[model samples]
Target: MTVKLTNIRIITCHGEEVIEKGEVLFNEKGILDVGQRVNTDEHEIQEIDGSGLTVLPGLIDSHVHLGMDSSPDPFANMKNEGPEDIAFKAVQQGYRFLQSGITSVRNLGTRYNVDISYRNAVSVGTVVGPRVFAAGSPIVMTGGHGHVMAIEADGCDEVRKAARSQIKAGADLLKVMATGGVLTEGNDPGATQFSEEELRCICQEANKASKTTAAHTIGTDGIKNAIRAGVTTIEHAYLLDEEAVELMLKKGTFLVPTLLAPRLILDKPGAVPEYMIDKVRKIIADHKISFQLAHQAGVPIAAGTDAGTPFNTPGLLSDELALMVEYGMTNHEAIYSATLGAAKAIQKETEIGSIENGKAADLIVVSGNPLENIRCLDSLVYVFSKGAIVHHAPVNKQEKQEQIV
Candidate 1:
C-alpha cells in the first residue's frame, strides 16, 4: 500500500530551502515522490493530513553502544550478561532511539559480536528499531582501552587479523582504540594505545572490505596517528592539537564528537563512579574548546551522543544538538551535522538522511518549525520509518477517528 502525507512543511536538510505546504508519497520500499501533490493512480493509498506540522529526515547517531546498560554500574552489567540477555536489552535501547526520531544508528563496539547480531535483527525486522550499522568489537592492545569488548592484539599482523575477524562476523565497520579511554579501569585518557603501524594495518584491512574505521582517540598524538593512518572518523577527540587538526583537514577525516557523554557523567556526581567524576571534570572544559576549534576549522562534525552510558541515556540527541549550537554551530549547521553529515560519516549518504524521492522514508513530524527553534524537535507528533507510521498521537477525538487509520 502507498502512503501520502499532505499539508506538511518539509526541511530536506540537504542545503535546500524549506518547502512549505508540501506532499510526500511513499511505499514500503522507499519514498516515491516528495514536494507538491504526489501524482498517483493507486486507489489503496493511505492519506494522512499533516497540517500544522514540520517534517524532516529522521536523525542519525554516528557513535553509540547498544548493549551497555545505562546505570551507575555499567561495566557490572557486562560482567555476567549473556548474549541473549544483552541482545534483548539492545532491542529496548533501539526502540527508545526510534521514539526520539533517530532512525539510523551506528553501534561502535560491543562484546562478543552482540552489536552485529543486533544490527542484523533490526535489518530483518525481527526487532523494531533504527537501521543499525555495527562495529562488532574494538581492536585494542593487550589490557588496552575497552578491554572487555576489545580484540586485544599487539602486533600489526594481529591487528589486521582482528579487523578481518570483525568483517567476517558481519560488521559494517571496524572500531579501534587509538587512545586510552576514561571508562577503562586505570587507563590514562591522554595516552595513545596502538602504534601507528598497527593502526594503518587495521585501516588497510577494513578498507579492503569496504568498511569505514572509527578510531576512539582522546589524546593528541593518538588523534594524529588515527588521521595519518587513514582512519575514516575520530571519536571523542577532545585533546586535538594543531597537528591533529591539520592532519584531519588534509585527510578529510570526520569527527563524531560525543560531547555530551562526559558532561552527563560530570553533572550527576552520585550517578557515576567517583573516579569518573574526577576524570570527566578534569577535561570537560577542554572538550568544549576542542569542539569549538573543530567547528572553526571547518571540519565535518557529526553529532553522536555516547548513549547507554551512565547518565547519558538514549533519546538525548536533542541535548547533543543544543550543545552543538552552544559551542559554535548555528541551528541549521547543528541539524545538518546530525542529518546529512552523519549519513556521510557512515558512508550512507545516497540512501537516507534527506527528504528526497527514491530514498528511505525515514522521517519525523514536529509541532513547530525546527529551523527557527530547534527545541521544537522535542515535540515530535509523528514518526515514520520506511513509510510506516511507527509512532503517532491524535490531537482530538473526532479528528483522531478520521486521521488514525
Candidate 2:
C-alpha cells in the first residue's frame, strides 16, 4: 500500500539541512518520493496529516549485544538461562528498540547465533523488529573480554579461523575483542588482548568476505593497534591518546563511542556489581575526554549505547545522541551520528540512513524537532519500519492545543 505524509518538517540527514512543509511518499518496498512537494496519485492513497511533526530517518544503534539482558550481573543471569530463553527475551527487547524509533541495529556480539536468528526472523516477516546486522559472535582472546558469548581464539591463525566461522554463520560483520573489559572477572579494561598480528588476520578475513569488523577496544594501545590492523570501527575507546586519534583520522576508521555504557554503570552503582562500578569510576572521566578529543579531531563518530551491558538498556539511541551533544558535538552532528553516521559505520548508508528517494522507509515522526532539542525524540508519535507503521500514539487534544497556541 502507498502512503504519503504531508505537511511535515523533514530532517534529512543527508547534510545539515531540513525541508520545511515537505511530503514523503512510500510503500512497503521503499521510499518512492520525498521533497518539499511529492507528486502522487490520489487513488487508494493513505495520507497521514503530519502537521506539527518532524520526520527523520529512524536511529541506528551500531553496537549492541542482544543476548545479554541489561540486568545487574547479566553474566550470572545468562549462566542460568538456556539459548531458547535468551532468544525469547531478545525478541521482546527487539520490540522495545522499535518502540524507541530505532529502525536498524547492529548486534556486535551475542551467544548461540541468537542475533543471526533474529535477523532472519525479522527478514522473513516472522517478527517485527528493527533491521538487524548480526555478527553472530565476537572473536576474543582466550579468557578475554566477553568470552562467555564469544569464540575464544589464540594467535593469528586462530583469529582468522574464528572470523571465518562467524562469516560462515551468516554474520554481517566480525566483532573482535581488542582489549579487556569492565564486566568480566579478572579483566582489566585497559589491558590489550589481541595482538596487532591477530587483529590484522581477523580484519583480513572479514575483508575477504566484503564484511566490516568492529573491535571492542578501550586502551589507547589497543585502539591504535586495531586501527593499524584495518578494523572498521572501534567500540568503547575509553582511553584514546593523540596518536590513536590521529591514526583513526588518517585511517578513516569510525568510532562507535558508547558513552552510555560506562555512564549507566556509574549511575546505578549499587544495582551493578561493585567491581564493575569501580572500573567505570576509573575510566568515566577518561572516556568523556577521549570522546571529546576524537570528535574535536574530526574522527568519524557513530552513536552506540553498548546496550545489553550492565544497566545500559536497549533502545536508548536518543540518550547516547544527547550525551554526544553534551560532550562536544552539535545537535545536528549528534543526530547524524546516530542516523547517517552510524549507517556508514555499519556500511548501510545506501540503504537506510536518510530521507531520500529509493531508500528504505525507516522513519519516525516526533512531536518536536530533534535538531533543536534531542529530548524531543521522547515524544515519538509514529515509527515506520520499511513503510509499515509499527508504532503509533494518538495526539491528545491538550497536546494539539499547546501546539496551536
Clashing pairs in 1: none
For candidate 1, lDDT tens digit of each residue in 98-145? 999999999988888898888887889898999999998788999998
Q: Positional deviation of 138 in candidate 1, in angstroms? A: 1.1
What is the lDDT of every predicted structure here? 0.86, 0.89
Considering every candidate listed, which one attains the maximal lDDT? 2
For every model shown, what is its TM-score relative to the native structure? 0.96, 0.98
Candidate 1 scores a C-alpha RMSD against the true structure in Å of 3.1
Q: After superposition, how far is residue 234 of candidate 2 from its true place, in Å?
A: 0.5
Q: After superposing candidate 1 on the true structure, give the runs of residues whose Cα lies further than 4 Å from its correct spot.
A: 396-405
In model 2, where is the ten-residue run with the lowest total lDDT?
396-405
Error of 1 at 323 (Å): 0.6
How would you encode candidate 2's per-residue C-alpha lDDT over 1-405 as one tens digit per residue? Answer: 788999999999998779998999998889999998999755888899888889999989988888789998887887677789889977988999999999889998888889999999999999988899999878999999988888999998788888888889999999998999998988998998999999999999999999999999988888988999999999989999999999998999999989988888888868888999888888889999999999999999888888898877878888998899888788899989989999999888899889999999999998867777788887889999999999999887579556434
